[model samples]
Target: MARITKGILGGFSGKVGTIVGANWRGKDIIRSIPNPSNKPPSEKQMLQQMKFKLVVSFLRPLGSIQKKYFGLNSGSKSRINLAVSYTINEAVQIVADVPELIYNKILITKGDLTGFQDVAATPQAGNKIGLTWEDNTVQGNAAGTDRVTIVCYCRELGSFAVFEAAAERSALAAEVTLPTIYTGREMQVWAYLNTKEKNVACNSSYLGALTMI
Candidate 1:
C-alpha cells in the first residue's frame, strides 16, 4: 500500500476518475470508489432497515422538541443524546407497526430516583395550561430536586409545550401558555424532577390527558 504524505502532492481536493481526494481532520487523503452491489437485501437486512426507519421516523420530530426544551436546560448534548438513543433502541419492538415514542413506550429514567408524586394539568381559557404537582420528598426523600420539567403533549395534533419550575424545598407548581392552535386539541401531560446535581433527572410521571378549551 502506498501512503501519499501531504508533502508529496501538496493538498488534493476533488474526484478524479476512480480515485477521490479529500482533506479529513486537516490531513489529505485519497481513496478508490466503492464497487456497486446488485444483490437483494436479505430478511435480516430488511428487518434491520425497517427497524431503523421506524426509529428514525419517530425520533426525527423530537429534535425540535429537544432543541427547544432540553438542549439548553441540560447544559450538554450527552443527556439529550442518551434519551434519543434509548428511544431509538426501544423502537425495535413495534408490535403493531406503530412508530412513536409514547410515554409507556420506553423506560423514562436512567436512575432509581423517585419522580413527582402526583401531577395534573388543565387547560384554562386563554390557551393556557395550568400544572400542579405534589412533592414526594416530604414523606420520603429522593434525590434532591432542583426543578420540575413538564411536557405537555398533544397526541392528536403532534404538538407540545415544555415548562420548567423551581422544585427545591417547594411543592413546585406552575402554568404554561401554549399557542392558540393548541386550544381545541386534547393533550397528555407528564412531569419529571430535575435534580440539583445537574444532568440527573427523575423518571417521568404520566399526568394524564387534558381537555384543551
Candidate 2:
C-alpha cells in the first residue's frame, strides 16, 4: 500500500488499472488488487464465511443502536465493527452444522452504565409487549432520567424492532406493539438503559421470549 501524496489526481478513489485507491481515516491510499484465485474454498473458509454472514445480517438492523451505545471505536474500527466482531466470535454457536446466534448472548449495547434489575417481558393484549423492571436509579451510574431502549427479535421473521427511549428508568414499565406481521410470532426481548445525555449505556439484559398476542 502507498499513500497518494502530491499528485495530479490527489485523493482519488476507485480502481484504476491494477491498483485500487480509496480514503482511509483521512489519507488517500492505493494498493494493488490481488489476483483472483481459481482454487476452491476450504471447508474452514466456508464455515468462516457462513459465520460472518450470519453475524452481519443479524446486526445490520441495529446499526443505529450499535453506533450510539456499543463499545467505543478503537483506532479505525467503528462501534458497529466491534459489535459484529464480538457477536461473531462469542455469541454464535455451531449446532449440527448450522451457525446460529445465541439470543441471550447478543449485546445490543455495551458500556459501564448501570443496568436494569428484575426485568421481565410479557405478552399483552392487542399485540403489545409489556416490559417491567425494578427502578435501580442512582445505582452505580444509573439515574431516574436515564432512557430505556427495548429490542425485540422475531426469528420467524429474521428481523428486529427497536424502541429507543421507550421510557425512563423511573417509569419501570413500557409497552411496545409489534407490527401486524408479527402478530403470531414469538419474540426475544432485551432491554438496556442509557443516560439522558446518551453518553453511555449499560450492557443489555435479555428478558426472555414471549408469543405476541
Best by lDDT: 2
Best-performing candidate as measured by TM-score:
2
Tell me the tens digit of each residue's lDDT in model 1 across 102-196: 55554333444466666676778887777676656655446435566667767677665766653452555777777777878887777666666
> Model 1 segments beyond 4 Å from truth?
1-36, 42-51, 57-82, 88-101, 106-109, 139-145, 155-157, 166-169
User: Cα deviation of 136 in candidate 1 (Å)?
Assistant: 2.1
Cα lDDT for residue 149, candidate 1: 65
TM per candidate comes to 0.60, 0.92
